[model samples]
Target chain A: QKEVEQDPGPLSVPEGAIVSLNCTYSNSAFQYFMWYRQYSRKGPELLMYTYSSGNKEDGRFTAQVDKSSKYISLFIRDSQPSDSATYLCASAANRGSTLGRLYFGRGTQLTVWP
Target chain B: NAGVTQTPKFRILKIGQSMTLQCTQDMNHNYMYWYRQDPGMGLKLIYYSVGAGITDKGEVPNGYNVSRSTTEDFPLRLELAAPSQTSVYFCASSYSMTLKSANEKLFFGSGTQLSVL
Candidate 1:
């Protein structure tokens, strides 16, 4: 099974709508969950980050992780057309004293229509 | 800081041809990684290094090799290009995985699009 699973969504939403994106994982060892936004032909950029199972809020973006259920979510409030991009979920196991490599999900393409 | 820079933004390779994808970071990060993103697929780790002189294979490492001779440079080499190797390659770096600050984020390069024919 893939380590991380996300719907490759071409999810279209009206401007100013609240957008919720989700991902499921199979590795319980993953300790760091991250959300990245990527525009066409560009690399992924870090949008939100969370550690373990909890919720973190950053302005209009919130990241939630439920280790028990092996699920994670990213909520974007007051979405705008500029928010239209591919959202990728990534996770990594925290090494004792180092940053481990991250595993990513198939990105979901989001489009916000004005 | 030009966080991470990748060279040869795009390339087209014939079968059996070889090339190198260059990556350089000015953040003085200790961890560097190479990943490839295929169409509609998640990014797959090709190789990673925690520090200069140390390298490890990731989820997908075949048909490629990497060397970290210095802290600022990590290059991926394609010895014999194959059609299956065509993909967008990304190079990333982080200060350290153990840090707790949000700024200790993974910064990625623009990406190198490779087409192996």
Candidate 2:
């Protein structure tokens, strides 16, 4: 099985709606969790990052990590059209090949309609 | 800082042709990585270097090679291009004070779109 799994969603939502993106992983060694935003033809940009399990808030985005369940999520409040993009969840194990290379999810494509 | 920069934003090659995807970072980060993103798939690591002259493979490394001769650059080379190798390539770099540091905040390049026909 893949180390990380996420629902590849083309989830469509109207402006001002709440959006939630999630991912689950099987690697217990993963110690760092992150969320990235990728627009078409662009590389994935780091959106949020957290260590261990907890919630980190930045602006309209919130990242939650549950080490016990190996699950992570990104929540966007009052979403806007400018927020439309693919959201990717990634994790890193301290002692892995590639020196902290992130294991990424398939990504959840979100569309915030105006 | 230009964080990370990749050359040849787009390229097309015939089968068995060879090419190199160049990556450079001004951050002077010790950790640099090369990844490929295929349609409907998550990014797969091709190669990574933690420091100059120290390179290693990631999840997907076949048909590809990499070199880290300097702290600022890590280049990925395809010896014999194949159609299956066509994908968007990304170069990323991160700084960790120690070798075992758990931090993995990555800064990526714009990307290089390559088509192997």
Candidate 3:
């Protein structure tokens, strides 16, 4: 199994609708979770970040991590057309006092239609 | 703060040709990384450095080499360009990865698109 697995979604949702993007990981040691948004021809930009199990909110985006289930999610409230982009989920483990390398999922393509 | 800057936004190279993708960060970050993104895939790490004079390989380091003589620069060199080496490369940096700011501190460069013919 891949360390991280995210659906390669072309999930189209109408504006103002709630959108949920998710990823599952095989490693239980992953302690830090992140969501990045990538526009066409641009680099991935950090959107939401959370540590271990819990929820974090920033404007229209919400990041959730469930350590026991080894799952993570990014929810968009009142989605908009501007939100169309590829969403990548990344995670890293803390090994002793050092941080391990980050592992990324292929990414889910989201299209918020107007 | 130009955060991170990478040169040669686009390039086309002949097979077996050698080149280096330049990257520099003004953030004074102690950690720097090189990653490549292929079509319809996630960014795969090539190499990373925790500090100057220290480097390590990530998931995909073959065909690529890197050096960190200073905190601001970490360049990736392709000794023999191959068709399989064609991809968009990105440079990123961060102060440190602590539990509270583990994933929050990273900053990325726009990227360099390279094509191997």
The prediction achieving the highest TM-score against the true structure is 1
* Per-residue accuracy of model 2 over A1-114 as CA lDDT, tens digit each: 999999998899999999999999999988778888999888888798887889999999999999988999999999999999999988877664533467899999999999
- Candidate 1 CAPRI-style tier: medium
Lowest-scoring 10 consecutive residues by lDDT in candidate 1 chain B? B96-105
Q: Give the candidate order by descending TM-score.
A: 1, 3, 2
DockQ of each: 0.67, 0.50, 0.55
Q: Which stretches of candidate 3 lie over 4 Å from their true place?
A: A96-100, B102-104
lDDT of 1 by residue, B1-117 (tens): 688999999999999999999999998988999999999999998998999999999889999999999999999999999999999999999887663656887789999999999
lDDT of 2 by residue, B39-65 (tens): 778999888888999998888999999
Q: What lDDT tens digits, residue by residue, belong to model 3 across residues A1-114?
A: 888998997899999999999999999888889998988777788888888899999999999999989999999999999999999999888763233378889999989888
In the predicted model 3, the residue pairs found to clash are none
lDDT at position B53, candidate 2: 100
Off by over 4 Å in 2: A96-99, B97-104
Clash pairs for candidate 1: A99-B97
Docking class of 3: medium
Candidate 1 residues lying further than 4 Å off, grouped into runs, are none
